[model samples]
Target: MPDLAAVADLEARLGRPLTPDEQARAGALLADASALVRDFTRQEITPVTGDTLVLRPVGVLLRLPQRPVTAVTSVSAVGPTGSVLGALSGWSWDGRDKVDLSCVSPAGSWPLSWTGPLPDTYQVIYDHGRATVPPGIVAVVCAMVLRTLLSPSMTAGMVAERIGAYNYQLQQGTGAAGASVVMTSADEKALARYGPRRFGTIALEAG
Candidate 1:
């Protein structure tokens, strides 16, 4: 799941079979690019079911976690004494922090010591994560992988060198133009165009 781009896709972009080392390194770098995608979106790719998400009540409103939430199984309030109020009834999930209640429950009105930084007033069990990734995002990831495979000297510049992040630069070129200094490789230019440049505001907030 860490690999954001398929090996076949990278091979297609590379236009050749990867060596054993290149395959391994590409896998690792793909993982890094994936992590960047996750971070850029501020969303988790793999969210487990039956996990609880805590929402701090801000007046009558509460903020939910990253969206496309599948279900809300239960709700509770944290008491001032740190004990949890039992599950409540008559609450409907309306999406994106919009919840309808037949009546106010004990937990909903529960106040923390300081409202500036609030303790979670509400807790719920919900399943949530991105349902789809944009094709352009996937293309960017594949481009990054292709760039890494095309440049061995630039391995140190890949995100996987630090457990999942982009180094923000293309690999140096090795193709010589006679005795003149070699220019950037076409592969590197493609990567620079498709890599981080793809993470626009829309892509950043993409689910």
Candidate 2:
């Protein structure tokens, strides 16, 4: 579903080749991992282009709705009834975390004097995000899925002995996991290595 990682990428992380069956299962796992990463970071992994906006807040940063924003088509504000308020001239996009709204045009700006928050007031039509998924994120996904695939029993909670005794314990086994939802320390390590997108007062471009 999400093309964050390739089958070859998954195979590389697995340190082996994937069977025909594994390939099908790997697709599901990769899709799950992609969604988890986006939710975890509160960042959009998919690329999208449309009109979006942000309201004025205490901080100078106005985080775009969808990010990392690839391009800003236009920046403007609208009233509750969708009336044109004003446009920011000296504003900037960090390309990741936020758009620097340093310049506020017109004193009677919406929310500055009216209701509704900034994230709702302003309108920015732009192409947001990238198609090239981060390698770190890909690695993280593969590692997580690999763990599940390598431990189907552990993930399935099938630790019971084959006998009626019902005794169970974790043991090594093999199978491609349908999905990997379990977060492990390794996942955190991978994310830390990649690091989160930093946000700050950025210039008009190159952020």
* lDDT winner: 2
Clashes of each: 0, 4
- For residues 112-131, could you state the per-residue lDDT of candidate 1 as single tens digits? 34344333466667766545
RMSD of each: 10.8, 7.0
lDDT of 2 by residue, 1-207 (tens): 355677788778668899887776777777777777776765666676664544443376655545566787666665667666666566777766466666755433434554555433455667766688787787777776665555435445343235475654435343233335455665776676444455432222221
How do the predictions measure up, each by TM-score? Answer: 0.59, 0.63
